[model samples]
Target: MEQLARLEDLPQTYIDHLTQSNLVPLWPSLRNVLPPKQPVPLTKATAWHYRDIKPLLLEAGELTPIEKAERRVLVLANPGHGLENMKATSSIYLGMQLLLPNEWAPSHRHTPNAVRLVVEGKGAFTTVEGQKCIMEHGDLILTPSGLWHEHGHDGDEPVIWLDVLDLPLVYYMEASYVEGGDVQQVQGTDLGHHYAKGVVPTVHFVRQNANFPLLRYAWTDTKNVLDALAADANHQAPAQVSFINPETGQDCQNIIGYSAIRVAPNETVQLTRRSAAQIFHVIEGQLSITVNSDHFDLARSDTACASCFAQIDLINRSEQPAYVFVADEAPLQKKLGLYSTRPRSV
Candidate 1:
């Protein structure tokens, strides 16, 4: 009764009633829970080196067969979330997957949308709804939510790729679902037929449909477009381009966005902050990125994450040009009217 009287002078009967109803008065905790400013648990900018993890991935491949493992991926867990969760940032998940020669990852689908940026090797391919798309170094491939896809390697060497997904968003929404395909192996390899027929067939088997018409964004074509843009004298920051849907001319998916940035030797690109967080992977050469006060020096096959609303700058410090692949959730943020950017003075 005395403690109840001291708790903001609430009556003993009232306090007892609140406890019996499994409810606590909010006045005591309101200030801590609802502060004046939006409080976000900021994730620090971090980097991962492919060279350091390559051996462990190779060893895992030798020890565990693809048949038993289902998918052989090593997640790049964020330090902010601790090792329990596989998220690379608050809203994104990043991983490195390895597929040895003649091995295959069985077909399956999930609610989270994913994008694959090839890091090394070649002759590996992913099949989306029976359409096979070849995977090579620097290629970008999309695996939209709930799409039946499988991976296989026919090359002599093991193939490795960076996998970026909007899984945290799916988990947050409580919309996660997974289903395994009936067929274990991909049957179609009609790459020439897709062009010869002049019609790309859609996957009719899955319940959830994909917004983008195309799945494969070949590195050769992407590089050619970037090269043409760089040839212009007006081109600044070397070049920057987004992978868009051929039919819609928007981002490939509504949940995620993919972009490529190139920087010439000894050049720096200044960019303002935006509401969407970004993760950058260095494809070639040496690069430096400063996100607000945090600085990251990245080499080939390294990755860095910049939090939302952090002013960022990218610099190519090597003699050769640098290529970077970026993944973000700007599309979703824009759809929700939560995306904003402010220009920074150079």
Candidate 2:
């Protein structure tokens, strides 16, 4: 690669004139925008253990009431992007949100799309687009852009869920904002279970008001499918299942992709590099993961981030089957015509 000129090489007088007109030359930073092989990534391989976060999250509960702290959450910010940015990757925003017993998070709609992965506790439910979708352990729920969603807890213990949003990208585009509203009456229950594997209701796949058909994906159903897929493959490397809209058979949401993987006991699987950044949250058993050079021993409820084109290896250390929830930027990348993956045998 040819050496690019540094900004300091430019004459001070020329720099001053360009500064006056708010114009900056790109030659000096050209390589940064267009690297030799792959694009430089600000997302880092990072981990957020639930063990460490639970205490602090509980403290937040004691520190303030739900009214004062709208979404009581501790953002899982990637250091490479600066912690203040509250981004897990360039387009993904992650946070550990807490909803104490009897507490309610008011109804509000935002321009950015979001999803909630149930981490701990239950009896918490999210009412999205007038449907009350119950939040259970390992369940996946979506709050699509421009949809009113609110959370409430009816369980005796506190409930915590991992919040993943396309906030960074939306905020960057200057289209991020929220509008509050009164509680919505439950128009219907979770419609996810209404449609089974390879089956869609002819009566009405979804209610008329629902633009994004399915809202809640039960872990039970997902686990059953994962186990079936793995067993059918005779406990092959690793089994994966994606969450998608039952109607269109596309990703559950357009901005981000959600999936779950089941790694057989004591089995190891290597996932080839991809252009999209990825996140892993262990839902069951323990996981030993290697992203590039960084390695993480993830226990249940532990979350980790990996940069773009990151070589990933997942090893189930426990005797029991290990299940992990995965989120990635593939959908958005594919939409932008930048999605790429290179497979490598282990």
Of the candidates shown, which would achieve the greatest lDDT relative to the real structure? 2
* Per-residue lDDT of model 1, residues 258-295, tens digit only: 99988888989887677788899988777999988888
Alpha-carbon TM-score of each model against the true structure: 0.85, 0.97
Candidate 1 error regions (>4 Å): 1-39, 184-210, 236-238
CA lDDT for candidate 2: 0.91
lDDT of 2 by residue, 98-121 (tens): 999999999999999999999999
By TM-score, how accurate is candidate 1?
A: 0.85
- Clashing residue pairs in candidate 2 are none
Worst 10 residues of 1 by lDDT: 190-199
